[model samples]
Target: MFIFKLLVILTLGYWIMMLGDTLWARKLMRQLPASPKPGGSASTESFASAGLAQPRGTTAKELPLVSVIIAAKEEEASITETVKHLLNQTYPRFEIIAVNDRSQDGTGHKLEELRKWSQGKRQVEVPLTIIHVTTLPAGWLGKNHALYQGFLQARGQVILFTDADVLFQPHALADAVHYMKETEADHLTLTPKIVVNSFWLSAFVQYFFFALSLYIRPWRANIDSQHKHGMGVGAFNMITRQAYDRIGTHQAFAFRPDDDLQLGMRVKQAGLRQRLASGRTQLAVEWYKSLREAVQGLEKNIFSGFQYRVLPAAAGVIGQLLLFFFPFVAIFVLDGWVFWSYVLSIVLMLSVYSLLIQSLIGKIGKELLVFPATVCLLSYIVTRSVWLTLRQGGIHWRGTFYVLEQLKKMKR
Candidate 1:
């Protein structure tokens, strides 16, 4: 009986923390000022003149070159379309380097085809390069090794690391370059509109982004703060040459499979400015084909993202469950005054969640009803993810197993 009472009290306390966290997340979301217009000026303008020009009928001058590096491992299914998207960018001065990291499939062949296609097209102005990573360097993660090879061959002022599963709008480069120039951001990452084909996929993706907004307060993440250690999705990230050098490039985080997060941390450590943009207009990425892929993909990063700290990761999962599930459970289970209290909690939580959902939907063109379902599904994903991380120690990706070490050793 004592233990039962303690459990109830603990659950109530957890619910209160979740309520506060939800409110805090809402406040943080509100704190993120509206993004500047595509070419608007910020307080810093030393680099503003280098911003991308409006697409008018002017002969292409020597614009700052952009090097787009895609690291692929057996991505024959999607590499061709990804290359096509990058090659078709409105930004004239750019290069697309597709690094085939020893793909068993026809990824190398497809890259060759893309290279030939680009060379043959008189209309396509930007250069194209294909680098086949025959061997990965010791201590270097496969994707990072490919990116390193691409960097060595690239002569661009800005380097973009993107996945082979992404499709970009023509103006993506232009908008990103312009924003980078205006903000003088060393590393710029945009949250893409995740394309989901199935109902479960849609639910998972929606909730994933929603929960991310709560945990990784974008405004706070952008600036340099003590509590600002967070992760970046490597699907689409832009880094300037200077910032890349300052952070020691991929070499700094050679062994880390969670390269994006490590890179973001390095940038923060170097005191370089970073920015996270809403890429609804510019970028779209398909993360996983099925639920299994999604789970595995998340498991790989969940531990690494937390720097291999089991306690924090577990806490995060528990907190997420309470936040997402408490309201519904309260609605069904509570009575009288307890029911009213539950109702108040649910209303507050839902109001905040609804705002975030509406904002995301307005940007990404997703249905409104998807948000509720996502909340429940995300809770399950988080719980399962925690279990997998604790049991397996890491996740498998692209035929490579990323082994998770103890939290203390993760910094190495």
Candidate 2:
């Protein structure tokens, strides 16, 4: 009974912290407005006259050119459509730079095809440029190297590094650019909608997103008092050219699989102005085709997110089991106050998920039902990633096997 009481106290304390964090994040999220509609009044110049958040080092009369850089490897499945959507963006002055990163599939051919197709469009002031990388240079991850290559050829004052599979609504860039201009943000990351095809996928992705958001406290990055919090998502990471250079560029984390998050860390460490906006209304990406695919896709970076360490990963897994899974099981076995405590934890967890799902999907539906199952899958993903990396003594990414020793050395 005493042990159960102690467990109850510990679990209650954990839930209270989780609740506080969730509420605070939700409060911050509520402060940001939704992405402006394409033909809406929220043009790039809308906030200019208000001077609420002026573009740094520039007059409000002219819009700065933005270079959208996409790094592609085996992305033929979605590359064409991705570029098509980008071409339709309502943002006035921006260029698209696509780097074909030595793809074994039709990705390179498709990019060239898109380049030709974009030429006939009247809206495009700058034509789509394609760089075909035929070889992988030593000591570099494919995606990171490809993005850096794109950066080298970019001419925009603002640079946006995004994935090949992400789809953008026409006003997406306009909304993002306006937000950055208004806030004078040096680095801005827009949260994209994760398109989940199946019911289980929705649950897993939503729960995973919730857990990650809680851990990172992305909104806290905006607070001047809290100097350490920062984040970047792969779908949309936009930064000024100057800020990018200040953070040592991609070369600082050249070999990291989790380059997006590393970029955010560098920005925070440098004391650059960083912000997060809810772009779910404008940006969407089908992260993985299915649960099996999701597991395989996460294998490359899940362990790397922990800096490829054992204890942290193990602790993470154990922590998830206790905080996420234990409540469901304990609720059934315990009685009286202990059982109610577990119930309260579940309630707190669901409340957070409900708020998060509403933000991501525009409405909260029934994805919360599979919460326990999603928890299990998340735990499984972390364990599988760690085990495979350790047992194979390396990670095979983008058809290349990187030795563990080499990866560890690059962690610095």
State the lDDT at 269 in candidate 1.
72
What's model 2's lDDT at 57? 45
State which candidate has the highest TM-score: 2
lDDT of 2 by residue, 1-412 (tens): 8987887788788878877877777666733354433322344344443222333444333778899999999999999999999988756678999999989999999998887767776656566889998888888999999999999999999999999999998777777777887788998887887788898887778888877776677777676455576788889999999999999999999899989988987888888988876787788899899988888988766998788999998898888888888889998898998999889988877877787667645666687777888888988999999999999999999888888888999997
lDDT of 1 by residue, 228-340 (tens): 46446687778999889988988878777678877776777777888776676677888888867887677555656566666787787777666556556656765665566
Candidates in order have lDDT scores of 0.70, 0.82
lDDT, candidate 1, residue 133?
Answer: 83
Total clashes, candidate 2? 1
